[model samples]
Target: MDFAGTDAAEKATYSTLTALMYRACEPIDDDTSVLARVVGCSVRTFKKSLEQLIRKKLILQLENGNLWSVQIEEELKNCNENLNRLSERAIKAANTKRNKQKDNSSREHDEVMTTSSRGHDNIMMSSSRQHINNNIYNKKLKLSF
Candidate 1:
């Protein structure tokens, strides 16, 4: 998969999703040091990035805990599934386009070969006619002799 092909929204969503999962492994309370740590995010920039994930609903707080449950993992999985499908489609489209271009190139090559063969045939025919004409002239000269 080409990284360049990934859209900004998708990339953002992927990272946010990962943050939710990482934080999920920790405790879920606001007072928990894990919250501060996750919120602090030295791990994959989740420090400040955690708040961003919460705001996006990609991460959620369990009603009253200091531990996060990775509330958005399933959703992120679905999104990732969709993204995978899209990537597959784009790759298939590119392959089809390449195949079509190859077919067109081969067709053009065949036409060129046919055209060259016809030109060679014409040259041969013209030379044959000139040879016949010379022969006729020679016969006339001999008869006159």
Candidate 2:
């Protein structure tokens, strides 16, 4: 939930972590640069996830600086599910905000048009004698943005 990093939570980090977990059954090299490439993220990004895994006690860092899992394989399995849920919720919230703004703008526009129409009707109601008084008076249509 609080996956904040200085710049970004960086989905790449999560992805790299998942890759590391899946491959935990394999022997770990002291360096994770090769696995980092396989996960399609930078070594720095992969390192961050590895650090998090250690911090969360989901993984243990050996004295030799190699990585090992701590019964977190099942948790790693849900990474994709978590990412999907997060994406869906974010999109839904964004769409809801957009729709609310559209509805508000439409209501404002309708109010302005209704006021204009009412003003036109009022003018017509009293203007027959005025039209006879002023031959030069003409109704001008207003355009609104």
Candidate 3:
């Protein structure tokens, strides 16, 4: 699956934090140093990762460095799924619209061709009738021998 945000290292750190949240049933109220030791990261790195998770809405930091709401991961997953579904629907709608436009254009072209063919046929018939009339008039002409 595609991950949101920066590189693999950040993602790995985020995963570690999530694992820590999941493993612990209740909210954690430990110091940053202890948390860093638990996640095997430097204290500064742990603090930065925690901030990133909060910024990304993947975790909620409560009062006094307490963290809660591990269900945020599930929520994020659901949101991503919905977004993908909506994107697919939008693509289908656009394709359907394009097809309808193509069909309408083809129908309009066919109608114009049919009308032009009828007009050409009418002109040919009128010219033929005039020619026949001239032939009859020539045959009726009188000449002295």
Candidate 4:
């Protein structure tokens, strides 16, 4: 909001800060020429804006000539950690669902096997009764003859 007023220098400084933050977790090189091009400003103007941001302690210049924003880095780290936790939870849920399905499948298979065994026993008993009946009928016919 401070950069929203009619101050062009503040706008440029805001743009520089935004560009640095846009690099996500990585630090940008302290190259004013390249940064000026990115911010659509002259190198002198970019340096002035950069100096303003540094003075405000909004941007950090590391010893390796890299510019960084600690807030952005911390935000990106938190986001990554959240994504990792969510991914792990998703994987665990999938495995639990798969195991439940497997258990159900095994139970269904056991039930089917039990029912089939019972059906087989019934068929064998019916066949044995039919054979006995045929033998009794044949014996009766022979005695009448």
Candidate 5:
């Protein structure tokens, strides 16, 4: 909005405010000189802009020597909460999909095992029949001799 300063001063104030918002509740170096350098402005200009912002109630200097924007802080908190909710939902969906895949794999394994067991039983029965037929043919040969 109306920062009430020269163009450079307004730009400095806007830059400083933006930097604080990027920090997201973390404190920044409150030294005016350091802040001026960060915002690419003279220390005097930065201080004047800061005062105007304070008088306008657009920014607050906390007791901990950090600057805060009430509007930005609230918005950041809301964004963080929404991100957490979406993350939880995504994790839950992934787990459900993994479980379904595991169940399908287990079912497939069981079907294979059952088929193998039936094949083994059939092989044993076939072998037993062959042995009985051979014995009968040998007895018949002895009787004919």
Candidate 6:
């Protein structure tokens, strides 16, 4: 529905092709020459327009020169499907990245906590050893006296 990326020429060609396609689909004969006359464009320009439409995948050119609009529907469907697939993939990738970051942060926190506890244990051991040495020195002084 949104032709944001398409150019003016392409839009014109598409509009013309839609008209041609509608006429082609009718029960009457699908005459390109008459269609060209009705569109007020030279037959050569009409052929170019048809080629442009086909190149853009907005129309389908049959072997018998009867154009069809089948590709228009198919292309839109394909675009929507591809967009959905890409969107899902992007979401999955973001989630994976987020989870990895959370895990890394958790591991970092755990390592910091372990290091902090180890430091506290070392301080406690040092203070206890100093207390025991002082007690032994005091006992020796009493014995010598």
RMSD, model 6, all Cα superposed? Answer: 11.7
Model 3 TM-score (2 dp): 0.44
Assess the local accuracy of residue 123 in candidate 4 as a C-alpha lDDT between 0 and 100. Answer: 99
Best by TM-score: 5
lDDT of 3 by residue, 1-145 (tens): 2366655545766676666666664566757788787777788887787777677766688776677655755755687799999999999999999999999999999999999999999999999999999898889656889
Give all TM-scores, in the order shown: 0.48, 0.39, 0.44, 0.72, 0.79, 0.44
Error of 3 at 72 (Å): 6.1
lDDT of 2 by residue, 12-95 (tens): 554455456576644366467786776667788777866775686655777887665544544565776898999999999999
Task: Tell me the lDDT of model 5 at 129.
Answer: 96
Runs with alpha carbons beyond 4 Å of true place in candidate 3: 1-76, 139-145
| lDDT scores in order | 0.60, 0.68, 0.75, 0.79, 0.78, 0.71
Worst 10 residues of 1 by lDDT: 1-10
RMSD (CA, Å), candidate 4 to true, equals: 4.0
Position 116, candidate 2: lDDT: 99
| Candidate 3 residue pairs in clash (backbone atoms < 3 Å) | none
lDDT of 4 by residue, 82-138 (tens): 999999999999999999999999999999999999999999999999999999888
Q: Write the per-residue lDDT of candidate 5 for residues 53-143, one digit (tens) a residue.
A: 7767777788988787777777778989999999999999999999999999999999999999999999999999999998878784345
- For residues 54-137, could you state the per-residue lDDT of candidate 6 as single tens digits? 676667766766666775556556877999999999999999999999999999999999999999999999999999998988
Clashes of 1: 13
Q: What TM-score does prediction 5 earn?
A: 0.79
